[model samples]
Target: MTMKKEYRVKKNTDFQAAFKKGKSFANRQFVVYSLKKPEQKHFRIGLSVSKKLGNAVMRNQIKRYIRQAFLEMENEIQNEYDYIIIARKPVTEMGLQEIKKSLTHVLKLSKVLKA
Candidate 1:
């Protein structure tokens, strides 16, 4: 049997602890939040494609595309941060390059690129 990897931002009590815990940023297409983990040696990410984007098909398509975009960026991100990508409504009209570009831009904003 095989198990899938788990990559979700956990619950924390302090919002300040959370914000100081990580940096976040948003653009027209998406919002990204990231935190540095003391124990993790590799980076893991979660994607949030909200209902506001569209129906199931549109949401899933964006999720898949973003996941792929993240995969392409795995080498560039810091291993200590657990990344979360939240999709905005505008993302539905964008292509993979736009998605990838957004992901890269947000990472830079979140300091994940520096991480």
Candidate 2:
């Protein structure tokens, strides 16, 4: 399933807010920053894959994998938080399952997944 637009963290201001105030959780493949906003009804997710990691195609591939993983785990995720997933160098070589595992680990560390 595709992630809905409203569930995406699309603005620079939102990214800045999350970055400035969010708590972080990291693994070998990803670093996730989370900011809880209890007033919102759903989670908002942002992804960052830098040019330093790879070329455009490689970056987009990682993003697709992340989105798919997030989509699969959306129901288990806690509501009202903004999540930013930053890809690490190792992430470029990882497959979807590995990415999912890393994402899950970070989410749990940040307490953004429902118990």
Candidate 3:
């Protein structure tokens, strides 16, 4: 299943806002930038997988894994923020479960994921 459009952060301005004003947290595989948006009723996420990581297929795979992770963890994640997730080189060596673990670590560091 795909994430709903309301849960995606699609605009360049939105990504930039998160980068500029949000608090950031990082682990070996990912960087998470989170900005609280009290007016928003649900969380929204933007993903960044650089070309340096891989070609289109690999990048898309990484994105799919991330979206899936978020979908699975939706109930545990806070719903009043905007999040920008940036993939790191190390993520290229990981599988879906590893990716989810790494992402969960970063989100925890940011205190956005409930214990």
Candidate 4:
């Protein structure tokens, strides 16, 4: 079977676009920004982990968790949206499934993923 390539929003401008052109919010465990990226026909996602949350290892852990969650759920998601996920301090204590649920919840609330 052919693999599906996941798209990522990597440029700083893409994050800026999500904040400026799209809607955003903060939950108890995460902050989410989402918008439609007309430049893409599929979905793209980005993740953030500030040093304020921890050292390099902690930050990388959070990034990895979010990225995997995004990849796994990207297919079931709606199209044309660019999403940015920022992990809060509490996120370090969460399990992968919890992270996935939070990501899915925010995306759904943003209406980037249709129910």
Candidate 5:
């Protein structure tokens, strides 16, 4: 299943705001930037997978994995934040489970995911 539209950070301005104002955390595979938005009732996420990682197909696959991971972890993540996740080069070599693990690690580091 795909992530719901409301949970996605689609606008460039939203992404820029997160990057400039959020606190960030990183692991080997991903970087997560989180900005608290108390006015928001649910968390929103933005993803970035650089073209340098691979072809369009590969990047799309990585994004799919990330969205699935978040879907699974929805209850564990805080709802009042905007998160921007950037895939690092190493993510090009990972499968869904590995991607989930890496994403979890970064989210935990950012304190957006409950331990």
Candidate 6:
């Protein structure tokens, strides 16, 4: 499925706001930061894969996997938050299922998953 622009957290200010004001949860492979934005009409997601994880190729691979994972849960997500998913080093070796599992686990911990 395609990720529409409305579903993306696109600004530096948005990233910084999530980091500064959002609640965070972590698992083995991912750190999730979420800020509740009640006025927003949709969930906006930002993916962050640091250089510490790898070189350009590896980082892109991890990002692609994360985007795919988020897409899987897109329809089931609530529309009141902005979420930032940060990939840790171990995530570099994880496949799609692992990524999806980690994302779901974190979102559940943060109570972002829709009923």
Which candidate leads in TM-score? 3
Model 1, position 32: C-alpha lDDT score = 78
TM-score of each candidate?
0.81, 0.96, 0.97, 0.85, 0.96, 0.93
What tens-digit string does per-residue lDDT give for candidate 5 at 5-37? 999999999999998999999988998999999
Shift in Å, residue 2, candidate 1: 14
lDDT of each structure?
A: 0.76, 0.91, 0.94, 0.78, 0.92, 0.89
State which candidate, 2 or 3, has the greater lDDT: 3
Q: Which 10 consecutive positions of candidate 4 have the poorest summed lDDT?
A: 1-10
State the lDDT of candidate 4 residue by residue for 1-115, as single tens digits.
Answer: 2214466778998788888888887778888887876677887778788899889998987877888887787677777777788888889888889988888877777666655
The candidate with the higher lDDT, 4 or 6, is: 6
Q: What lDDT score is found at residue 114 in candidate 1?
A: 49
Q: Please, what are the lDDT tens digits per residue for candidate 6 over residues 1-115?
A: 7778998888999999999999999998889999999999988889888899889999998888888888888887888999998889899888999989888988898888988
lDDT of 5 at 50: 95
Off by over 4 Å in 6: none
lDDT minimum window of 10 residues, candidate 6: 69-78
For every candidate structure, what is the RMSD over all alpha carbons to the true structure, in angstroms?
3.7, 0.8, 0.8, 2.8, 0.8, 1.2
Off by over 4 Å in 4: 1-6
Between candidates 3 and 6, the one scoring higher on lDDT is 3
Residue pairs with colliding backbones in model 3 are none
Instruction: Return model 2's CA RMSD, one decimal.
Output: 0.8
CA lDDT for candidate 1: 0.76
Of candidate 3, the 10-residue stretch with the lowest lDDT total is 106-115
Rank all candidate structures by their lDDT, best first, as comma-separated numbers. Answer: 3, 5, 2, 6, 4, 1
Worst 10 residues of 1 by lDDT: 1-10
